[model samples]
Target: MKTVAVIDYGMGNLHSASKALEHVADRNTRVVVTCDPETILQADRVVLPGVGAIRDCMAEIRRRGVDDVVRQVVASERPLLGICVGMQVMLNHSEENGGVECLGLMSGNVKFFGRNLKDAAGNKLKVPHMGWSMVDQHQPHALWQGIEKNARFYFVHSYHAHAVDDEVAVGRCDYGVNFDVALAKGTVFAVQFHPEKSAANGLRLLENFLQWSP
Candidate 1:
């Protein structure tokens, strides 16, 4: 049976994420929400999810030794997915919390949306970038399979990733400014939006992830 471990370091909306995964996982698949390193490392796939401040999230991740587990999983090249703050922490650094160092698994930086921001219409936009936004697919990735090109995904973040290499950026979105919304490198796939809250399109993405080979 395939197993997918949802890493629980005390920061993510574990219930929602696990439920969504469970709903889409095949009948033989088992979805586990756990903090145990052994269980996470042994699972067929790993999901890093968070929905809080980067400082607190990183603190818990490191404190619980999940950081090392994440690194190990990435090294294994097993299918891995990161959501929201989960995605941000994959970068080298973040402007949040004045500034916080991250896992540096990927060469990039997390930046704030800034106070002075305006939309294409010259209208002021809010921080956190709440609500749904179009996710423009940049390249053909397994995660994007079955998902429409420019499908709207739920987003609620104040900071976004800026990958050093654009080649890893598989999805892009625009708030007041364009930013990398989804990144794909090797077996890792991360997104700034909440797939569980994205309705049909979101569920399709999760289902695709479950069936994705790499």
Candidate 2:
């Protein structure tokens, strides 16, 4: 049976993510939410999902040896997905929690969306940037197979990643400023939005990840 390891480092939206993956996954596949390095390394795919600060996330990740496993997954060229803060932590550093160093899997920095934010209409935007927004799919990826271009995805983050290379950003969303909401590099693909909470499009993304080979 195919196994998808949703690494639980105590900071991710574990229940929701695992449930969603199981819901979309084939009956032959097994979805496991665990912190065990052996289970993670043995899985066909790995998902790193988070909903909190980068500092605490990194602390738990290293404390449980999940950091090394994540790097190994990347090095092994297996399909790996990062969600929300999970995606943020993939960068070189983050300004959150008074700044924290990240995994450096990708060349980028996470930055706050600024205290006073606004849309193009000049309306003030909230800090968390919560709610649904339209995402621009820049590149044609296998994950974007069924999902329509400019589809809306759920987002609830104050900090966004700034990739050093332009090609790293496969999807983007605009609030007050245009920032990368979805990034892909090598075997890794991470999103700033919560796919589990995103309804149909989100389910489709997770479904694609299950069948994704790289």
- Residue 27, model 1: lDDT of 92
Model 1: CA > 4 A from native: none
lDDT of 2 at 90: 92
Tens-place lDDT digits, model 2, residues 1-214: 9999999989999999999999999989999998888899999999999988889999998898888999998888999999999999899999999999999999999999998898888899899889999999976688988999999999998898888888999999888988888999888999999999999999999999998876
lDDT of 2: 0.92
lDDT of each: 0.92, 0.92
lDDT of candidate 1 over 116-157, digit per residue (tens): 889988999999799999999987898888888999999999
- Relative to the true structure, candidate 2 reaches a TM of 0.98
- The reply for model 2, stretches above 4 Å from the true place, is none
Q: Mark the 10 consecutive residues where model 2 has the least summed lDDT.
A: 137-146
